[model samples]
Target: MPLDELPPPKVELSDDDWRARLTPEEFAVLRRAGTERPGVGEYTNTHTEGVYTCRACGAELFRSTEKFDSHCGWPSFFDPSHSDAVILRPDDSLGMRRVEVLCASCHSHLGHVFSGEGYPTPTDQRYCINSISLRLVPAED
Candidate 1:
């Protein structure tokens, strides 16, 4: 989608302020629409018990229980923790069409979701998330 077509992201941060708060890499992936190297994200191999929340705005997006190894070099989930926490947009970048996932609260780019996949879960959905887009909070006992 064209930059002008999509609704303006709900989250607003002053460029300088955001820059000061986030590292160059974080800002690139979170704000500047950049993608980290596949399989290099922190959560790709993370098997800890926790919830994955938006890094920009702590909205719960995924649970560890729904996470699976798609071997797609990203954190894949069969379903989101909550439906209202995410938004999907059609992304046509690099000459390929894909669905882009974003935080509904902050509009931070989370990743993409694909369908028609055989995953060991009820939903045959694969939410390929960027490791940089999430912060894992271990479940408290």
Candidate 2:
């Protein structure tokens, strides 16, 4: 679909404000479609209990209970906390086919989704997310 045909981003941020709030690296991934180095994300080896929210808008996206290791060099989740919190787009970049995931609230590029995978989780869906796109909030003890 054309760019105009797709739904508008759920959240908006001023470039100056966002820059002041995030580092250069964070801004690139969250706002400029940049990817982090493999196995470098704090959540990749994390097994803590928390909720992952959008870095740009702080909208809840995924829960810690749903997180799993997909070995895809990014944070993976079996499912999102809510359906309406995210939006999927057909990505044809890099001469490959992939389903792009975005935060419904801010339209920030979260990651991609793949199906029919062998995951230890009950759900066969894999939401391969970029760590830079999320902020983890620890669950209450």
Candidate 3:
């Protein structure tokens, strides 16, 4: 779905400022690159039609149409809402090699994405995202 309005420009804030604006959990996931327990995210089983924006910066990231049940214990998207909405990077943390997904605007860690573990999506990729890293803005009726 197209965004209702343009994304509030790229966000740049200090650690203190970010901490002040987010809850502990949100801070962990968005700033500290922490992960929530599997299968316990708010958006994992959600079928609401809307756009998912960065919890910290309100930048549009994923759309409901891209969401699908990957049964991977997190919200999964076949692609981002826009190409420039997210930034991908190499993550070698936890002794595993993976591509990490981050909000392009705020550089907050959203999650990791994997490929070749196909689920019949157009992109042939699963953007495994954290629920706390996103805020759903339901579509208008």
The Cα local distance difference test for each model comes to: 0.85, 0.85, 0.92
Clashes of 2: 3
For residues 1-141, what per-residue lDDT tens digits would candidate 3 score against the true structure? 112233543788988999999999999999999999999999999999999999999999999999999999999999999999998878888999899998989888899999999689999999999999999999999
TM-score of each candidate? 0.89, 0.90, 0.92
Candidate 3: which stretches are off by over 4 Å? Answer: 1-9
Q: List per-candidate RMSD values in Å.
A: 1.8, 1.7, 5.8
**Model 2 spans with C-alpha error above 4 angstroms:** 1-3
Give the worst 10-residue stretch by lDDT in candidate 2: 1-10
Better of 2 and 3 by TM-score: 3
Cα-based RMSD of candidate 1 = 1.8
Q: For residues 21-63, could you state the per-residue lDDT of candidate 1 as single tens digits? A: 7778887887777889997999999999999998877789999
Summed backbone clashes in each candidate are: 0, 3, 0
Candidate 3 local distance difference test against the native: 0.92
* Ten contiguous residues with the weakest lDDT in model 3: 1-10
Model 2: per-residue Cα lDDT over 81-138, one tens digit each: 9988888889888899888887888777788899887777878999988888888999
Which residue pairs in candidate 1 collide? none
